[model samples]
Target: MTDLQFQCTGVRPEPFGAGPTLLFGLRIEEADHQPVHAIALRCQIRIEPARRQYEPEEVGMLGDLFGEPDRWSSTLKPLQFAHASITVPGFTGTTHVDLPVPCTYDTEVASASYFRALSRGEVPLLLLFSGTVFTGRDGFRAEPIPWHKETSFLMPVDVWRSMIEQYFPHTGWLRIRQDVLEALRRYRSARALPSWEQVFEELLATADAKGGD
Candidate 1:
């Protein structure tokens, strides 16, 4: 089997996409100088939270994900970021392709919550690759891409923020339970609140008053 090496050159926000998505630039090169017919690839991306330093505010915001800063060494672990798949056309020596990573604003997901808590800096990522490589001098011969094949990259935090902002500018989404949502809707209707933010603020104000008493 010909050895294939993968490199993540850079990442960017894809302007036109079905939803918020990032395009990771990947370079796949063959070491044995054999022509590649095509590659059916599946990439699993993971976030290494412990790989970078976090700001005081960021640490506080990320408490739910990694607990207190002091306990991060134990709490922080690899977080699955996304799963992406793509096919690269035939290439002789090497080829470059775009790997689309779909993103979600829902804080319910660990990866989404982690990204939102970050104020600045890069996010360390591990990319594990798998699938089949179709290559043969005469015709297309199937070869299994090793599961151990992997690469790492530091994704800029701003890129993630930008992609999210483009889809949900100045807004954060919360996936509340259906029952809670119904209660909130009823409360909002009773108070004639124009937005959910207003409802939350009012609830907080009321809670503060009670606490003060």
Candidate 2:
């Protein structure tokens, strides 16, 4: 595995009447001081909006729009908005990574719903993007990006499989595959058992096993 580090360079908010959309750019670097042959990057977006209060009568607007409130009673509350995971691959060296253009939403509630659904491990919530390596005179320069407007939600196993397939598809990367597969298998098992500390312990055990192997 390559020692990788990333820094968020900029975040710009594009206004859309009431709510704003955010665009994020990152700078990824190799921390090992060695040239990077390839790299895969992943990111998650989180938003927390301030709470607000409304009169019981005026609350009808939110009710008509979002349907029944998740919680309601005496006070009106403000909503939050957040984004799902955004992943991009293929980096030869330090490079500027720009995320796909964001989509606008009418209300914070709508955005928060999408964010919460993704956080809860729903399908069709992660946006995956990739860039291929182009050969140059000396080495390869990572360029020519590919992006998707839509999101791809994969099962936990499928997510591991996809990453393995993308980064190292051959048996020579067996160590990495073993690490990922074992973790996925443990996650699958723990989902049935449902113990938080056990799940975490299993994850650490898998990492240790991979390192030992």
lDDT of 2 by residue, 1-213 (tens): 344445555544433323233455667665545455554433443222212333455344546434555555432233322333344554455777665334332224454233322322222223333333333434656543334312322223233233333433442211236787677667768577465456657779889999999
Give the top-scoring candidate (lDDT): 1
Q: What is the TM-score (0 to 1) of candidate 1? A: 0.96
**TM-score leader:** 1
Worst 10 residues of 2 by lDDT: 116-125
lDDT of 2 at 199: 65
Clashing pairs in 2: 52-78, 124-153
lDDT of each: 0.93, 0.43
TM-score per candidate: 0.96, 0.31
